[model samples]
Target chain A: MRVTPAVELDDVSFGYRPGQRVLEGVTLRLGEGEFVAVAGPNGGGKTTLVRLILGLERPGDGRALLFGEPAHRFSQRRTLGYLAQRFELGGDAPATVREVVSAGRLAAGGLIGPMRRRDRELVAEAIERVGLSERADAPLRTLSGGQQQRAFIAKALAGEPSLLVLDEPTTGVDAETQESLAALLDRLHSELGVTIVYVSHEFGAVERFVQRLVLVRRTIVFDGSPQELPGIWHDPSHVHA
Target chain B: MLESEFMRLALGAGIVIGVLAPAVGFFLVQRRQSLIGDGIGHVAFAGVAAGILLDVSPVLTALVAAVLGGVVIEVLRSRGGTAGDQALALVFYTGIALGVVLISTAGALNVDLFQYLFGSILTVTRTDLVVIAALGAVGLATVGLLYRALAAVVVDEEGARVAGVPIGGLNIAVAALAAVTVALSMRVVGILLVAALMVLPVSAAGRMAWSMRSTFVLAMAIGLGSSLVGLTISYYADLPPGGTIVLAAAVVFGTAVVVSAARGR
Candidate 1:
């Protein structure tokens, strides 16, 4: 039997309102331990795709599956870690790095219970992985942009998710921070064998690490290896190119 | 300070509400929904007036009305029918208008309205104390248990939902907790001033706290201190307890702001 894909979008379509679709009949799949980068221009439904895969929003048509289970019905949410774009945490939040990371265990221990010893260990481990152990107790707002991103990454890593979904993880960071994030993603994929699906508008930074590319323009316009990117970019018929 | 039995009961009730207000208010301030307390207060006033008109217990009626009002605000927010502040304003004005009309029709404006509007802590009975204790316990316990989920939602709602946190249910639960907090605090601070009691201490604590947990604990302490000190001053000065308590909290908030600015935090 074939192994179940980490994520599968079978002819999915979505729109925020009626008759104005953002994503239309897009089918994609990410196998276990695969590193895929979704590249698209602004308003190309990259974030919507992430939302569907995470079950934050449902598909208007077709299906979204995570580990062979339907997106909405998938109960093992602890297995998926999501790093949203910058400004996602809002301004002036008072949560510390450790406290924010520990929230990842909410799915494991639930909302109404105390954190166990194991949860604490996982939180510490996650923070250490992000190299923020020294600043674990510091408030998230005090951190720089890249450090805040790492803190959120630690939060996602705390859950020990097998499938990591990141949406524009390097949007507003400097070039050096972007390179660090790429290196971290590489390590996460190679060492931890975590399946990463990240969305980005900037292709040069993450192009080397991603094995496959799913270029979207309100639909799955191109789905192939990174070598085929030039062909799509050169094609005059692709309006969004 | 606690010489009279009435004073003892008032203190007991005040202490519980003092802790409960800031506990719930931490999230309210963080979420930028501090004015929700004012909206709920107005709804509770309508409830009190309805209860008087129907010859039922006003406190109990206010509890139900406030909860319902909170749920309405949540529903409107979820439906995207109105903006968050708009929803609050809608409920707030409707409630106050309904209350005034009910009271006018009933012609019960002599003493009952005065007590509900300004509060009468010295008039708190044993039954009121018991109700306050029970409701305050449940409200505070809910906040304690759901602290992580609630905080997660406040920090990043979509992230929390992706992590399998039930955002809608938890939001409603929070609104309900706020409703109960408003209802119970009405006795100590009155309908007009309960929101101040809930928000001012948390605002002060937010300026100094390094983390969320510290913020919560600090807010509770500030609230408790303000309540006790305010009650004492009101007793000696013969002023309204509700106004005095709120003024004390405001003073603390101002002091906190100054100190934070001095420390450049």
Candidate 2:
């Protein structure tokens, strides 16, 4: 039997206000182990699409499914890793790199219970995988932007998620850091076989890493291999026929 | 220190409230909801006034009202009917107005509202002590059990939701805990000064601690220390106990700020 697609949006529609549709009739599917980049101009519903897939927001119409289950009913959240657009250490509560990564284990058993031995091992392994083992005990604020981003990725990796969703993961970092993030993600995809879906408005740095590109403009205007994108987007406001 | 029965009861209740208030307040500060305590304090006042109107135990009534107010605040927040601060301000002013109206309509001017407003540690009876102990125990237990969920929500609410942390339930749980803490604390510091106890010590702890766990321990220690020292000073100097205690906490916070700044933090 064929494995289910990691994410599926069928004729999905969503709006923040009663009549202002952000995304309308958006239908797309991503098979397991696929590396897909969703690129769009600002206010083009890229974040909204990610929110719908993460079940943070429901589609106003049609359906959103994850791993063949309806998004709202899919409770095995441990299998899905999500890095929000604005991840930051809150207020004065200083968290170390290891502590930040350990939060990924929250899905296994919420913040109240004891973590199994396996959870510890996974946290340690994720820290190492993200190349932050040396800074595991360092406070997150002490790390560079790149290192902090890696720590967050390690946090996502600690859950051992098969489907990883990142929203604007490279919004603030330097080009070098973005390149390193892209490399780390490419490795996770090719080696660990973690399916990746990332949303970004800036595509120059990330385009080489993704196998497929989904250009979202209120709706998915383009979905094809990365090579096919340049020929079609002479102007972003209007797509080529 | 434990010479008189009233002194003993006062000290006992002080210790309990000291530990419990800052423990809950740490998360409040983390989530930038420190003002929720102030809002809940006003609502608890309304509860107390209504209780007086009905000839009921004011503490019990305050507990119920504060909890309901907390839940309402969370519900309003989740519904996005208004901004968080706007919603809280609405509740805060309405609660205080309702309290004033209830007190006047019942002609409870002779009911010693000042005692509840500014606290009367010497007036704490055996029944008051029991109520404080029970509420303190429940409040602390809830915080302990929900430590991780609370931390996750405070750190990143949207991330916590995606991880299936039940954001709505945790929000209300924290709010209710704040309400209970406010009600129990009213016995020590009074409704007017309760938010100080909840916030100052935690702010001091946050200045020094490097992690969430350490912040909790340090905040509890500071809270307990302030209460004990304040109570002793009040006993010797014949000062108002609640004001002394709150002033002590403020001193600790100010000292922490200066010391941290001196250390080039």
Candidate 3:
């Protein structure tokens, strides 16, 4: 008898409106600790898949499962930390970096009456883990775009999620900051044993850090390692590097 | 002096609206749906005009119309897609225009419609005050019961939906509550300034407050402070209390903006 994977989608299909099918017969599975990088073209349903996995969108047909149960049935939403591509932390929102980071704890039902000492420490640890210790007290609007993104990530990290799902985390971040974020993500998977499912267009940039590559072009074209993806996705005759 | 019965009723209504307006307005501001409240106010005015024409209580008509308008807006937003904004704008303008035509052509009542438009404290009957109190209590309780869900929805609708927050239901609930507040506030601040009452206090509070709970509490305090001061000023200066209240709120907003800028925000 084999154990079911952490996440599984069985012949899932979806459309934004009445009859336009954006994704069809899309089946996918991720084990408990797998760091799967979802790669695809610009209009491919990579982000849509992430949304379905996060239980943000209901599949038009078929079943979606998390931990062997229906994805919608899983009430422990705190177990997954998600960073959307366009998360808005409003300019006039009066929250420090630490306060914003603490917001992640909200999913865990961690806001019990008030901010506890342990919650504060968790916030501190999450901030430090993101290398944002010095800027914890700084207001969110004052930080650079990269720092702001990191703060949002730290907020997600504060919940101690078993799975981290990020959509283009390094989209607007500088190269140096992108490398640091990649390293941090790698450390999270390797050392902390966290499952990571990230969607990105830049496959070459994240190829080294990912364990499994799910090449998505509206549907699952290939599900294999980064090395195995080149032959399936690339032209064999024109292979370089 | 508060010796006069009408003055007492007006003062009481002012204070209650002070609290109710800002509390509901905070949610509107957060969701960027402040304009929705304005549309509700206009629809409520049509209800008021109908009440005057039919020789029934305007409050009842306003309440019914406001709620219906809110639900209509929600439906339009969800179903109409590209035409949502235009539909809402049409609802607002049509309501106001219909209200004007109805009130002016209403040869039966001989009641001055402009009194309701700008809010006349002298006209606030005890029955009106009682209605205000009851509706205010319901509005506040609804907000309290659903604070967590409301906070989640306002912060991130997509995230909250994924977390099983019931986005559509919550949105409808918010619209319903906004309608109620607008209708209740119409009798005190007038339909034209209902959005001002809702937005100004909360906007001022947002400048200094970090948490939702604190922001709400501060907005209430600011509202109460302004209403009391405004009422007193109006009584002494022989001016319109609603205008005074709005002016006071504007001053608070201006001060907050200045201080925030000075602090290099």
Task: Return the top candidate by lDDT.
Answer: 2
Q: Which docking band does candidate 3 fall into?
A: acceptable
Task: Tell the DockQ for candidate 3.
Answer: 0.27
- Which DockQ-derived CAPRI band holds candidate 2? medium
Worst 10 residues of 1 chain A by lDDT: A232-241
Segments of candidate 3 deviating more than 4 angstroms: A11-21, A58-63, A69-80, A98-138, A157-162, A190-192, A203-206, A229-241, B78-80, B97-111, B208-215
Ranking by DockQ: 2, 1, 3
Q: What is the alpha-carbon lDDT for the whole of candidate 3?
A: 0.79
Pull out the clashing pairs in model 2.
none
lDDT of 1 by residue, A86-188 (tens): 5355424478988888877777657875788888998999888888999999998899988989888888888888888889998878877887887788877
Q: For model 1, what is the alpha-carbon lDDT of residue A208? A: 70
Model 2 lDDT tens row, B177-254: 999998898889999998899899999987887776787889999999999999999999999999999999999999
TM-score of each: 0.94, 0.94, 0.84
Best by DockQ: 2
**DockQ, all models:** 0.53, 0.56, 0.27
lDDT of 3 by residue, A1-241 (tens): 9787888999999889999888889999999998888878878888888878877778999888877777877776767788877876632445578767766766565322456678779989989988899998876767888788888888778778877888888787676667667777888788778888888765555667889989887789889988876555742322131
TM-score of 3: 0.84
Model 3, chain B only, scores a TM-score of 0.95
